[model samples]
Target: MKKEKGLQKATDFSGIKTIDDLHQHLKTNPDDADELGEHFITKLNNAYAEKNKTESDYEDLLVALDEWEEKPEAASKIRNTTYEANYLIIGACIHNHIVNNICFPGVTAIQRETGLSRTTIYRHLKLDDFRPYDKLIRGKHELMAKRALEHLYYIGVVDRNAGALKTFIELTGFSKKSSASNINNYIQINNLKITREELDQLPKEITEQIAELISEGLQAKDCDKKMEDMTT
Candidate 1:
């Protein structure tokens, strides 16, 4: 994870009023300001990375801070104290990370982790400025698809006779039409030696059934067993 070059140089912080304001103040005014600034920036960058936030999100936060400056009430609420400011910044970073990057199976998982009521989470999500859940879910699916495709490629390279699509379906336990679409897209995009004909040869009914088992929360092994039973 490379640090953004823009953040390396100290930015004007007189107007911005957030936990980051204190961070910038300390970095530029202290006797060992250079060292302290570097240290603080490193920790801040690490927090962003830990939350799986991209550089774009960091830029968004900066913009949000700028917007906050215009709202005196919000600006006044920002913590100036070092310890409290650090804590709040870290918390917000984690929350942002989860909202933008994590794909929770349900609201309960989110509630357990954030200690926020499901209603509050939903309300925040409804705000246009908040992270887009749909995009996050799509991103998660794309990642899973990529990994599955890579595995298929490896198996194909190692053993030409291996049933890569069937193996991938079994391994990922992804039976949905979307999952199938992702796999097909990856196959086409990479122009991998594997053929659509090969994938199409697998029984569509079994694939769809596997997806149904997945939606029912069946484990991969159980789904495999169900698939086997269906075939035999």
Candidate 2:
């Protein structure tokens, strides 16, 4: 009796609370000890399997998150590019030009200054770098000079106090040109290592246009500074 009591105490310490609970647990309850033990073992195995699967799932999720963090630019293509994005870019460039006094002439002004037609001005706006300018011109039923002017204001091209649309088309002083070492640094940082073969694959006209723009931009460095000095 004392040995049974000690055994009972040990089982109780092991968390087998009651005899009925113990009987149920040990598969020695009344009639189906072996079958009941088998069921209980199966349940224990299932619980362990579920815990391992959960841990594996969590590890996979962490790895996926790490990969995403490592390559944000890869995720960028997941987003669709839209006309609105084009507008914002052009708007920013135009605004910068306006603020710096690199202005394009008006409808008649472009005609007088560049010897380009109003239709040409519209066409110029269609270019990727000038899309925002084009959107301003084409957004409404009316020929809204105000909308174009407002976009310029938003881009910080026109001074609020001056209340005038600065030209977004032209800047001066291009003869003394310098290479943009900064652009090379940028290309390297962005991993945009284009080969000569890739350049050749581009349409000849586009390649020429890109070359001209780069040459013009490098030539026009410090153009606004020269203009400011001339004014002073």
lDDT, candidates in the order shown: 0.46, 0.39
In candidate 2, the residue pairs with backbone N, CA or C atoms under 3 Å apart (3 or more residues apart, or in different chains) clash, namely 98-157, 99-157, 103-167, 103-168, 104-167, 104-168, 104-169
State in Å the error of residue 158, model 2. Answer: 27
Show model 1 residue runs off by greater than 4 Å: 1-113, 117-120, 123-141, 165-232
Each prediction's total of clashing residue pairs, residues at least 3 apart in sequence or on different chains, is 1, 7
TM-score of 1: 0.26
Q: How high is each candidate's TM-score? A: 0.26, 0.17
lDDT of 1 by residue, 34-128 (tens): 44334444544664446433323233343344343455433223212222333344347456767887843355554454444344444444545
Query: Please, what are the lDDT tens digits per residue for candidate 2 over residues 105-207?
Result: 3445433433333433444465664443334336552446556655654443322221121222111111123134323221121656654345446685664
Clashing pairs in 1: 175-211
Off by over 4 Å in 2: 1-191, 228-232
